[model samples]
Structure formats: structure tokens, C-alpha cells
Target: MNEDRRGLLAATAAAALAAVAGPAKAQESETPAGPPPGTPEGNPGDFDFLTGEWRIHHRWRSGPQSAEWLEFDGEATVVGILGGICSVEELRIPARNLFGMGLRLLDQERNVWQDHWVNKNSGVVAAPGEYGGFTNGVGTWSSIYDQDGVTMISQGIWDEITPTSTRWRQRISADNGATWQETWIMHWRRA
Candidate 1:
């Protein structure tokens, strides 16, 4: 009798464990973390030119002399992260006492790249993600960012991209892109 009771208890415990774990296992199997099955990938190697260390010359303007470009020299490190699904850039400008980071990811389903930017000044990864891809060797990405309850469009363009150097610019439009003003530009060379 005791042997039968022990067997029944073991069976019941096993059933209970399976019941608790069954839904979680099914949920995981139903959805995946990466690209979905049959998801067409975006342009492979579109950002390959950016996957290296670089000496960066930055041009930025704000305030009373908003139209002027105040240039500074900086260093940047770019790495192919997330198994090539994304790349990250770390930038430092000692003269300006500034640091920034950019994370660029390719969405297979959307067939576009999303660029996320953040800086030490605001400490907010608050920039709306810019989404675009290279066309005819030129890349453009834009997103809306908020400032003091005002909506702004941030547009970025990559021009003169080459094996060792590239020129990129950032512009902001307060009037829904009807007009754009260049706010930042960077000239990057292989370091």
C-alpha cells in the first residue's frame, strides 16, 4: 500500500510541474526573439563602412551664433555588435567635454535601419529612432524629437562615404520638415 502511495505522489508531482511549465514553454516556442521566419533581411553590409575606429572632426552650432560651425577634433570607436544585427558607436570630444553614443540596427522585416542616439549632456536616449538605408551609396535617416513640448524633425544624411572616410550631417526642422537647419556635421577618417 505504501509503495502505491509513493508512486501516486511522484506521478502527481510530475503532473503539477508539467502543468506549471507547459504554458511558458509553449509561449516561447510560439514567438522568437530574432527576425521572424521568412523575414527578408535589409541590405546586408549597408553599414559595413562604419565598423571601425575613426578620427572624427565635429562641427556643431547653437545659441546666438547658431549658423556657425564650431569645429572640434574627437575620437570614435565603432563596433559590430549584436551578431551584426546592429552596430554601436562611442564618441568622445575632450575639448568640448562631450560624449555620445549611437546604436544602429537593421530590421529585417521592415527592411530599414534604425539609428538611436544619446549624449552625456541630456542623458536621455530620448531621440526618436531614425530609420532609413543606403541608396546609391548615400544614406539618410530621420526621426522626430521633442524639445520643450515642441515637435522637431531630425534628419541625418551620410555623404561622400568611402573606404576610409565619410561625411555626415544632422539637421533639425521645427516646421515639420518644411525647412531644415544644419545643426551638426562630422568628418570621419579611419584611425
Candidate 2:
């Protein structure tokens, strides 16, 4: 009888160990953290052209200064952060002599890009804008804002970019959307 009781107690202990270890073993076999199924990894080549610092020259034509040119220097830096969800660009221009930061969030679910911009001087941000998927490696964004009682529409396009340089244009429309004016033209070269 004593031997039989000892055997039964050992059996009970073994059963308890099995019950506790089963779930842990199953969890360990489960899939580890990784990119979601069907989600491709981000390519460094896609953002290579924006890797370096840039110097910008701006020109514009409007009103009495119509057809006239204004020049300024702008510096740009692009960085990939937040698990590759977006790339943030910080630009400084000595012309308006303002510093601004913009964020380009890449939505993997919708495959679209959303842009947000804020003026550092006045700490005001215009309405956020969304652009469709990139085509032929080019994209455009525009926004309207009232600055010191002057209504200004700002438009920009990124064209012909490589890992080293990108061509960008910024234009302003004063007369709403009916009539447009080009206020700033900027070409960014890697520095």
C-alpha cells in the first residue's frame, strides 16, 4: 500500500508539470514578431536621393515684382524614422529666413502619402494635404494659408530625383485658385 501511494503521488506531480509547461511550449512555437504577411520591406534606394544636405535658390514673379526674380538659400535633410513608417524633412531658408519641418508619412495599408507642414516663425500649420501614389518617381503637394493678411497658396513638386539631388518648385497663388502666381522657384542640390 505504501509503494502504491508513493507511485500515485509521483503521477500527480507529473500531471501538474505537464499542465503548466504545455501552454508555454505552445507559445514559444508561435510565430515571432516580423513584417506582416504580404508587406514588403522598405528600400533604402527609394529615399537615397534625399540623403544629403541641400542648398536652394529661389526665384519668383508677382505684381510690381512680376517677372522679377528673388533668390534665397534653403537647406534640406531627410531622415527615416519610426520603424520606417515615414521620412521627416527639415528645411531652413534664409530668404523668408524661416525654418520649417515637414513630415511625409507613408501609409503602407493604403499605399498613399500624407504630408504635413508647419511654419516655425508663426508656429501655424496649414491644412494637411494628401497626394496620390507616386508615379514615375514624382509627387506634388499644395496648401493655402493667410500670412499677415496676405492670402498665399503654396505649391511644390518633386521631380527627377536621384540619391544625390532633387529638383523642387514652390509657387504661390494670391488670387485664390482662379488666378495663380509663382512666388518661389527652388532647385535643391546635394551639398
Candidate 3:
């Protein structure tokens, strides 16, 4: 190529690179906003208690009208990330050929945590997850969803925490949180 042509090409490439890098440089310098004034701060290590391998005892109901309880055994592994600001749980029931994952993320700015679940069958992350934060030593998260054209609420609680064991239970409310029916419970022992 001619000298002029080469010079023009170099300038054009430099301009293009600058266009891409300028905004990224600005973004790098900007810090994420924290919780608003008067909003409580969240503990980054809130999920640290659950980090480890666990043997799970599961008791679940088939549906809202189910009278008989089904009991099963499962295993779970919990991993803490980002200094416990985020955690993931992998639960497997080999006998039933079931696998599921739960991901919990803290929204530092909002001072709350969101819980998401992904079933192996679908391999999709459920969005707009249940939101809550740890209170004392227990964690409670809840969400509202439509069930048979009715607005139903679902809640999950983590309690009975100890060094070697913990208990989690799920409840559903058809009356807008006025009443709750326990549907599933799991006991976790360190494995």
C-alpha cells in the first residue's frame, strides 16, 4: 500500500480501538452503588454456615391434597463463593434419578439475598428469585406465584442450625400469607 494509505489505515484502527476502550475505562473506575441511606447492610459471610458436604433426609408431599408423606435420602454439597456473598448447593437423589441446584446471591446494594433454583431436567435458571436475608442464624426467603389462577405464596426457611446438622422446610400459603401448609422438609447432616 502507498504511504498515505498506510497512514490513514493506522489512524482509523487507532480511532476504532479508542472508541471501544474509552467507555470500558470509565466503567472500570466506577464502583457499584451500595445500599441507600438508612438501609441495613448485609453480612457477606451469611451463608458460611452451610458450606460443606451433607447427607440429606428428605420428606416431601406429592401435592397440596396429598395425605401421605414420601421419605427419601439424598446428598448435597454446598459451596461458598465471593467470601460467602454467594453460595450454590447441588442436591442429588440417586434413587429417584433427581438432581437440582440452588444458587443464592446477595444484592449488596439492596441488603437482601435472592435464591434461585435450577432443576437438571430443564437446565434453566429460574428468574426473579425469592428474596430475603438472614435473621439471627436462620434464613428465610419467599416468593409469590400464580397457582391454578390463584395467587399463592411460597416460603423456605433454614433453621435448626448446628455445627453438624441443619434443617430446612418449605411452606405454601394459599391465603396470602395468612395460613401456611408445610409441604417439604429436609434434614442435613455433615457427611
Candidate 4:
């Protein structure tokens, strides 16, 4: 009777172990091997130039404000946040008391850059616009606004860049690009 009791206890323990382990083993087998979330799988090289910090020197003038110009120091940071689908850039200008955020995304099908921008003061965002791809290390976008009794059209271009710095220009045309009134030109040094 003692030997039978011992044998029964061993069998019960083995059965419990199998019952617990069976589901876990099956789950592991069913899981598919795939790339991790937010991993950049395609065309990651297109936006690689925008992944740094920069100190910007901005200059601008409009209409009769040409002689009495506005100057300010600003900064820009572009990072691959949020699933690597796009890059977000934050720009800060202390002299003009302005700050802005911009989003840049590359459309694989269209082979163009989709650019969006917003200003802190106005709280208005520019509409979706297409950029003529980055070639010779340059890209630009422009928008027109008629808010607060001011008809202002603005254009921004990333003209040049190195490992540690970038040069950008923000030009505003009150009378359209036909007679462009250069509003802000800035150079950014890496910080």
C-alpha cells in the first residue's frame, strides 16, 4: 500500500507540470518572428540629415521694415520620434519672440517631402504642401496666410548643412513671391 501511494503521488505531480507547461510552449510556438515596433524598415536614409541640434541666427525685413531689421537667435532639433514614420522639428526664436514646430515626412510613392509648419504666436498651421525632394542638399516650402488683417506669405528653405551646422532661410512675401520681401534668414550651429 505504501509503494502504491508513492507511485500515485509521482504521477499526479508529473501531470500537473505538463498541464502548466503545455499552454506556454504552445504560445511560444505560435508567435511569429517579426521586426520590432517603430523600427525603420524602408527608406530610412532620406531623413538622416535632420537628426541633430542646431543653433540658428535669423535675419529678416519686410516693406519699410527693411532698414530696421529684426534679428534673433534660434534653435532647431529634428528627431525620429513616434514610430519613425516622420521627423518632428522644434524651432525656437528668442529675439522675435517666436517658436514653431514642423513635421517632415517622405512619401515613398510620390517621391516628395510633405511639410507642415505651425507658429506659436498665431497658433495656425500651414497646410499640407509638397516639396521638390531634397536635391543638392536643399528643400523648401511656402504658404500664404490672411489672418489678423495681415496678408503674409512665408517660405522656408533648408539651404545647406554640415555635420555640425545648417543654414536656413525664411522669406515672407506680403505681395506674393512675385515681389519677395525677405523676412528671416538664419544659420544654425550644432549645439
Q: Give per-model TM-scores.
A: 0.68, 0.57, 0.76, 0.58
Tens digits of per-residue lDDT for model 3, 3-90:
4533443353344334323566564564233222322235788888887778999999988879778899998777666666777677
Clashing pairs in 1: none
The count of residue-pair clashes in candidate 1 stands at 0
> Could you tell me which 10 consecutive residues in candidate 2 have the lowest summed lDDT?
31-40
Pairs that collide in candidate 2 are 49-162, 49-163
Candidate RMSDs in order? 15.7, 20.6, 14.1, 20.1
Q: Candidate 4's C-alpha lDDT?
A: 0.58
Best candidate (score: lDDT): 3
Question: How does residue 149 of candidate 2 score in lDDT?
Answer: 96
Candidate 3 deviant stretches above 4 angstroms: 1-42
Give candidate 2 regions above 4 Å deviation: 1-48, 62-65, 124-126, 142-155, 171-181
Residue 8, model 4, lDDT? 45
The regions of model 4 sitting more than 4 angstroms off are 1-44, 62-67, 81-85, 121-125, 142-155, 172-181
Residue 40 local lDDT, model 2: 28
Query: All models: lDDT?
Result: 0.68, 0.55, 0.73, 0.58
